[model samples]
Target: MNEEVGSLHERLARLEQLLTAAQRKPAEPAWRRPTSRESRWAVSAAVLGAVALQLLLPERLAFHPEWLLPALELLLLVLLFPGPRARKRRTTSLLRGGGLTLAGTVSVANGWSAVLLIRGLVRGSEGSDARTLLTAAAAIWLTNVIVFALWYWEWDRGGPVARAEGIADYPDFLFPQMQSRELTQADWEPAFADYLYVSFTNATAFSPTDTMPLSRWAKLLMGVQALISLLILALVVARSVNIFGG
Candidate 1:
């Protein structure tokens, strides 16, 4: 009886050890390092371009100050760019947080502006020209694409830099290339371009195409993005028909 009890405790201890080992993530290899930086230029350009497009939208669809949202977005861009080498320095976290916050704010502003544009168009355009309305719609659609791309770029394992660092063991998105070793280098990490593709595909299809979301937040974000895109597409179509018919 004594021997059996001792053996059972030993087995339990061994099981716990295995479980702990499984829970712990392996350290990133020395040769395979995460990129300290991401596509700052591309993302910055996208933000600036989106701001420019927003400027083209009618005054009624814009924020009260007209320049408020764009000005704030541009300020974030200035903070993000022309800085000391943040990637190699201690300011990495601050820079990353700033970028993420900027993207989220711009997304909310653009999304809200888009809702206003759609509402105006659906409600007899409020005496606005069809051409101007459609142009604003196009700009809003492009802004939607850019904003969500920024969101995906900023997120997914806690942004590109963190992902490259391998700080987060879990993947929020599972891409096909991630599965095939031959498709990429052994130390390959997804970049802003990959996330951009994920966003574009998701927006177009209104669902996951090549990449699958893994986490609850990931799934929810994607679903919300799809819903917004659908509403935009539907409203645009309905308004277009009304414009031609009347």
Candidate 2:
């Protein structure tokens, strides 16, 4: 009886050891990293904020229209330019990064134009007529449209190329050949092709898994922008109708 009991105890211990070893095995890597949905949300929020600020704030509080426009323009330029040094510093896929940079530029330009128009309206200038206000709104809307289009285009190109090549799809590493290596376009083709592939792929797929912090921040930005735009639009329309008699 004693021998049998000892054998049972030993067998149980071995089974537990095997289970622990199995549990320690590393998980398989993901086939593809997730997209940055948080970033998209953040961008959307920023756009909404620009619109809201134009619409809601009293002309007095939101003064300095010129400053916002130029600042945004500068930001766009920095983001879009893919100098060799930048490529080395950040391993983002070339095409997607460039596309994003272009989108940022377009957004800033459009936003600045809107700000100028709003400034005119607040200043009570003749240029602040209904026609101008409408034009400004249209321009802002166009900026969003352009950005969306660019995003989609990049996404379309990036997806298939990554899969076909069996390479990691992260933008930072995928499109090195598209960038300027030493202040020349000589190496642009290969880099550009790789970039296009990554951008297209990422656009279609959700950004690789990101922490909740980024996602929340993006949502917050979107909400702020949306609120600002809605308020500004409302005020502008109301003021315009009052001045012009419908």
Candidate 3:
């Protein structure tokens, strides 16, 4: 009888252990840590888009000489592609710094334009031509999307290099695939395109939609982007409509 009791207890303990391990297994991340760095092609394209948008703006809205900002941005972009033989750590740091600087410069230029445009609108001196106003508004709106996408790509999870190295145990942005791991492949990782999509949705919806911001900085950034988008739509678009109607 005692021998039977011992065997029954041992079986119950073994069963409990299996249950615990099974529960833990499901809690583990479904995706694998990224082994390689993300590609820069998307980022490069986004920067180019921002540059083009800046060029498209009216000369009055653009900085003096109009080409200075884009020229400086292009110069910084060159730093992003260093010599192949450069040390890996140094290269990564340089690329991150250069990218941030380039994005910041674009952002500052766009912001200056936005301020000037708003000032002109308020003073009843700008956007007199509906077509010109609409065109300038579209350019600013698109540039806003591109620059925010760059910010999201560069800041998430301590930037792309850190993300590739698996330094951040948790993501700054909580993508839908991250939550619904079963829906995505094991090797899935967020890329520049993903960030761009997030930026686009946030700008359009004026709030986070599918992918949510998990960090304070992410929330703040999204909020600022939404505010800028709102200002452009409400002020510039409305002014254009008024001009056309009148």
Candidate 4:
């Protein structure tokens, strides 16, 4: 009887040790992060929805029409790239941050424009009054101009290029050389995070250079387009106030 009790105690100790080991085991890895493609699609959907709402909604219900254009432009930008399946969390976060910032700026500008219109209404200024409407419209246009100009300046100074060709693809040797390792999905998370941090923190000073400037004409066209947009925004606001009598 004494021997049997001792054996039973030993077995119990072994069982406890096994249980502790099992408890200490790490869990399976978390689901892989979404790819860049997924993020771009999400952004695109949000933008398209915003645009559709602006066009379809009543004036009283419209959030900001001025926002629709810039939002669309930003969406087009992200969609241009064929992003990898595995992206870094930081990268996606930064992209979302930038998008949100752009959206907020547009929304605020639109709100201010509406405020001007409302004030005009309270003062019994008719929307048909050219001077009153133009003044308000001009203010809105200027706001958009300033915003777009800054965006252009930042891009010209050193914004990321989606892709480079020929001499335009010259490498940067000034910074410490990162090892050219093929990035796996796991690797993408950290890399994307670092990419996002660098992109936002140094957006103004991150231009890449090569022997030849790619699409110099295209850059000029973009500037022209921004100017055209500002003009259109002004005209539309002026017309809209008059048409709606608000």
Q: How many residue pairs clash in each candidate?
A: 1, 38, 0, 4
Range of the 10 consecutive residues with the lowest summed lDDT in candidate 3: 25-34
Error of 1 at 210 (Å): 0.7
**lDDT scores of the candidates, listed in order:** 0.79, 0.45, 0.85, 0.42
Model 1 local distance difference test score: 0.79
Model 4 has an lDDT value of 0.42
Please give, for residues 81-182, the per-residue lDDT of candidate 4 as tens digits: 343332565664465446446545544544455455555544545356556455545544344334333343223213222211111232221111222224
RMSD of each: 6.4, 13.3, 2.8, 17.7
How far residue 100's Cα lies from its native spot in candidate 4, in Å, is 3.4
Output the TM-score of candidate 1.
0.81
lDDT of 1 by residue, 126-196 (tens): 42466776687788888888888888877888876677677776788887767786877777777767777
Residue range with the least summed lDDT across 10 consecutive positions in model 2? 205-214
Q: Which parts of model 3 have CA positions greater than 4 angstroms off?
A: 6-12, 15-32, 82-87
Which regions of candidate 4 fall more than 4 Å away from where they truly are? 18-39, 55-97, 105-246
Worst-scoring 10-residue span by lDDT in model 4: 159-168
Q: Return the TM-score for candidate 3, rounded to 2 decimals.
A: 0.89
Best by TM-score: 3
User: What RMSD value applies to candidate 4?
Assistant: 17.7
